[model samples]
Target: MRNLDLTTLRSFVAVAEQGGVTRAAAALNLTQSAVSMQLKRLEELLGQDLLDRSNRRIALTNSGELLLTYARRLVELNDEAVGRLTDDVYEGELILGAPYDVIYPVVPQVLKRFNALCPRVKVQLRSSTSLKLLESLRRGEVDLILTTEEAPGQGGETLTEMPLRWVGAQGGLSWKRKPLKLAFCNVCIFRAGVLRKLDDAGIEWEMAVDSDDDRSVEALISADLAVGALLEDSVPPQLEAIQSCGALPDLGIQKINMYGADSRKEVLGELADMLRQGFAASRGPVAVPKALTA
Candidate 1:
């Protein structure tokens, strides 16, 4: 009988999530050569190659993808068991970062649940864009982050995915206006996708309002000051999805991700589980546009 080692599995998962052996080594506090050897050993044990080394960036083989799902769960369960056996009470400070606008309907409730589960654990939240949150994570400023990915499977572990659609005030013809007015955060990841889609479809647009404040952008959309692009599931009640906007291209699905720091695997894993459950439970009707589906 062959025994699968937890240490090797941890290295394999770190490589997959970090996107390279070098990054994984840094995160795992191991040498790059050691990390590579661990992966080789794991592959030999499984009798299959797990990674495609053809390109400069690492990508998972089909077998690799299949194992990743199980690997993550196994590692999580292993850590959870150890933590539960070692400590009945967990007390520590965790700094969490997230975009103010995207944290709703899920994050707040996740934090509430986390607090209840680990009453002595102190949590400090920092509101920032995904870009900034990732930087903070790297800088050791934030222990975990809930962030939005501009495209599906692009970055981070996706909690849920929703399409981006045009939105305008209910009963308003803002979408029909020429040089279609828009409002959004200047640093928003959706901004590039929104512009690229419009440009590719030969639709003219102008930025009418730009701010970091989500409420301001939503206000602009609500008052017919401009049309906006947002996740289908996140469209405001005062606004409606605009399906007939001329020649507008679909902004592909955006993923909400839960990213955690390299340390505190047990705590982060528990929080991640809670986040996934909370989002899964709260997910409402998806509002994909008809044309996009076609």
Candidate 2:
């Protein structure tokens, strides 16, 4: 029998987990035909059908089920080996992911310091919504993720909890309007908390702008289109805190977290500690910087 290739095994596993070629292809960023071809090659090498296509719904045959168990174990071991070997490279790459709103302002300085401390380590940074970052982490695409504690999805260790507050354009509208206009990211935890509090208080509110990027939200607020809730540290200087809005009902604070594969426990732990200390130092009560709290 020809030896099964890792690529083929990975494709097969993706299909099995996703339950369809189209979905697996999308998940793996491969064409459907390519995924099918890999599966065929894998079956040919193993000399047994891995999926029962006789039925409308795909099901693993007895032999296929057994092979899947071994395939998954092999893939996991392969990944672990790769991680270990790469760690030994000294010039190893660290893939880091985070939401832009939380990291954009501070990441450059953090990266510079990290590089100076571990000059041999190469870092690649990606910015996206917390949900997307967590998805990438689960798929083993990213080695580390830093996200708000209120992130909807699971997985990750809490590193720090940052305060969130309500803010708006200086001299903007009053809060008595029913359904206050609010600017926020559609999936933001801080936004969700704000909404929940409004609902509980029976205060109607409308989404002035549902955006994923902080820059867009900032623009809306700057234009005085609507008020916004943001991390205490993230509010830009042109805005003023609407303390009269009632403490944002204590959005319970948002925590920052770090996540990675199980094998990365040691390194992730170290990074998390460094991040916690940095955040604490940066958060001293300095009358919110003028740039952030005009």
Candidate 3:
């Protein structure tokens, strides 16, 4: 009979999520050599190599990918169990606001880690456009918010910056349409800037989809009925970035900003830390978990 160790699994998951042993070690507050050894031990136990060391950056082998899916769940459950049993529990709801497109590649993972630490905290996620979310934050409707905009305005801090890309359904031809058919939700922060860029570049366009609902815009884009703007990493699996290739004008890099970071600082400490880690992870392609984009 054999058993898996939670400590080693934690190290493995950190390494996967952090994109390297060094970053993973920093995240876990463990020495680099210690994280490396745990990864080595896990590989020995599983009888398979988990990390591909061929490149400068670490990448998961197929076996590594398979193991990661289970590891995250196991570690999350373990933490939740411990936190629920040992910690002074906080029981309340947290109203969170975030733009729909920026939800991926960060928010979901942050929710998991936050939930584990504060098992009783019901994280109420409010998805809306950045400006609306900021308004919600100011109105005290949301506890904290994540926004994607050209830059953070007053009372907001930038988490990470990512280039906005022209996104469309796989092999979509909407970009080629004369008077380009654009699809974006009514209040999207990117919409106005995108339109300006198109006009400045002399690309004539019309709103093919202009519903206030995100799904309507996404549906039209995904069906190849129109094209839209999305963050570089948050683009859905069914979509691919349309190559500008001197055809479409480029949008500026957008910043993911956090609002109301100081409010309830003590209560949201764990969640804020997790969000920082999650956003930092988005900088590297290797750190992105499937759950993020999915």
Candidate 4:
């Protein structure tokens, strides 16, 4: 009956995600009473109960679940519209997210160029694992993200498929008889694919080191502690691809992609073109830095 407020919808989504008033309050940086009052106001306006609050934990009612889905879409659309109108001057903040490995190699140059083109724009960068970055995107926290594509079910468009290669300290370890000393990120798609291939080949191997951080894995490989798989374009300067590994049986290559809410299609489209150009320029016929070459 009454027009819903955007702030109330945001609060509702936060509560749904956190599953309790206290937690939701903490996440939204609002007092528990304030959050509860907003939830109550939302339910009153909608003329239906959103959550079943009889229990300790908040459980979304069927209506709440439906509203939660629509609420996220609505918020995304609202934010995109606001950003577009405000961004005509290219003077507002653009929050971008990507894996450190991808961004560290060429993003500085990309940002430098982007800033020169849109000097008034303020750019903010956040680096994290692909999964975490995607979560941030869905939460409406990031304007755009660059990440590796997984199987078809995973969200995001496939921009480029670059080869994956095994790299380790130069001349430090030989793979003749020893099970390869492997280093990898815990949930890395590239690492998972590599491990799967190794299992299928019946290659005796053990994880000499594991971390969720890319820098840590790179450090291990650089120190000759273990071998690691990386995008052909992202191998570090201190390491060399292991010739014995022999092209890694394809590992299906790693895909780089861009993602944002559909409502931000205009902004995402412009951003995507810029990224495609950057990737092509970096990976094209012109030579890239040795650190970036496979």
Candidate 5:
């Protein structure tokens, strides 16, 4: 049986994502001709035309689109296997700051993958509000940080974007109250934006709880005392995303951005790449915390 080459597959995936062979070559650190040759070889081997070259910009053909899905997964799986098995070791410590809202379901995966790649590189994770994290980054107190913002800040690389959500008790009626009561961390990044959105909608709001502790806010929200805003996937177990269905104004989208790290360092660059992959990975469904129902 004929086999597809992983190297060529990676090039094809890059070209598809980067939008051209030259761009892919630069990204892969391979010559343009070399990337072109790999793409041709892959196409010949498959006996299918994968790219539509008739247009000014190359685009994926139906077959290429079909192949891209599998290619990404295969490439990711291969890289993961190598990272886990390789004995490559690097020693260093990097301080990483991120907001509490986005620490789960992505950061854990990134840390695990980074550990496999650089077992000796100590990464100290500090969780705070986004505004505070950005401040720490500016002060050089943290080597790198991730921020949640409506728009990415200067020198920031956005990893992913999700819609901001109004979250509250699963079966609560607080949303029905006028001058909607809100529970937010003292330095929560969403506070300003959410308030603006509410104001633009001509809705009045009152702060029901203001504490630096996330659990304190969550606890109050869980009791139907107040509501809060968060990114869609960041909503906690105790609080469910409010299906406002027009009852509440939309809080808009939030971007998860990386800032304050120079990619010149190999390990730091790898960590950023890992975060990119981690955020892109499939997150099937959010599970209900059993404790919530118990």
Candidate 6:
């Protein structure tokens, strides 16, 4: 009986998802020729043309569509089987630190999935500003940390760049008021961008709340006390992204990054992959960022 290569299926899936071979190659950390070769080999094995390349963009043939469905299932099942079979029975405590903003919504999902994969590993979470989290990592108080870079290309393994936007209370006119009232942490990455832009735009601003607790900042915004800046996706339901409020500077994008004392730890590696996967699922199939690939 002929056998199918899981590696070929993976390459096909990457090509399909990325919408082109070049991007798929970059995403897979494979050369263009290598990806093309994988696809060619897979097509040859099945005795069918999987992709229709008549136009500038490639589309899937009828057979390719059918194969994609099975490919995805096969890949998922194979991954599950491998994980179940090869996973080390690990028992240890992992200390994870991240900004309060990341703790909500995002990190929780990562933790839930990680717990399922490594039930014996206990994760102790610490929430603070990115600056504080970095300090904790440096001081050997935390095993791993997720943080936003203060400047472009500054620190940690960058996962992805997230847009920073101004957020204010729902149905509130706080953004319209001059001398903007802001609520953010003292060491927040967005704070400097917010301040710099506001200054450049000739808009006056004051810190209505300066706490590292994201809940406190949310509370301030919910009460219409001040506008805050946060990653566009991380903005809570109580707050609405305020982009058109006049003279507000574009806060730009910040890199979401991970830092750890030891990336080689079994538990930490798995947890990091889970975190990256969670974030990637939200943003579409993302290549594990280069820094963490090692």
TM-score top scorer: 3
TM values, all candidates: 0.62, 0.59, 0.80, 0.61, 0.68, 0.68
Q: By lDDT, is 2 or 3 better?
A: 3
Candidate 6, poorest ten consecutive residues by summed lDDT: 285-294
Ranked candidates, highest TM-score first? 3, 5, 6, 1, 4, 2
146, model 6: CA deviation in Å?
1.5
**Could you give candidate 1's per-residue lDDT for residues 1-294 as a string of tens digits?**
988899999888767755566656654657889989999999999999888777654578889889888898888777666655544667778888877757776678678657656666788989988878888877878888888886433336777777778888998788888998988888877888788888888889999985888788889999998988877766778998888745567777778887773355677776777776656544543222110100
The global Cα lDDT (0 to 1) of model 3 is 0.81
The residue-by-residue lDDT of candidate 5 on 1-294, one tens digit each, is: 889899999888767655466545655667889988998999999999987777554667788889989998888777767765663555689988888778886788679767766767899999988899888887878888899998888899887788899999988999999879999887888888888888989999999975789889889999999999888877777889989888789777788899965656777887877776656531323222110100
Arranged by lDDT, best first: 3, 5, 6, 1, 4, 2
Q: Compared with the true structure, what per-residue lDDT tens digits does model 6 show for residues 1-294?
A: 779999999888767755566656655667889999999999999999988777654678889889989997887677666556655665689999887666655688678657656666789998778878777777889998888774523346766667888888999889888778999877776777678888888888888985767678789899998988888777788889986745677788787788873467877887887676545444532332211110
lDDT of 3 by residue, 1-294 (tens): 668899999988887776677667656767889988998999999899888777655678889999999998999889888879855657677888888778875788778777777887789999888889888888789888899888889988888898999999999898888879989888888889999998899889999974789888888999998899998877888889999697988787999998777876566766766777677655644545322211
> Which 10 residues in a row give candidate 2 its minimum summed lDDT?
285-294
What lDDT would candidate 6 get against the real structure?
0.75
Relative to the unseen true structure, what is the C-alpha lDDT of residue 110 in candidate 4, on a scale of 0 to 100? 60
Which segments of candidate 5 are over 4 A away from where they belong? Answer: 1-89, 282-294
Residue pairs with backbone atoms closer than 3 Å in model 1 (clashes) = none
Query: Which residue pairs collide in model 4, if any?
Result: none
Model 5 root mean square deviation, Cα atoms: 8.7
> What number of backbone clashes does candidate 1 have, counting pairs of residues 3 or more apart or in separate chains?
0
lDDT string, candidate 4, 1-294, tens digits: 478799899777666644455545654557889988998999988899987767644467788888988998886666666655655656657788988778854577567546544555777999888878888888989888888765433457665667777788878573443677788889776776788898887777889765777778878888887888777777778888778745234455677887763445454455556666556434433321111111
lDDT of 5 at 84: 54
- Which whole-number lDDT from 0 to 100 does residue 200 have in model 1? 85
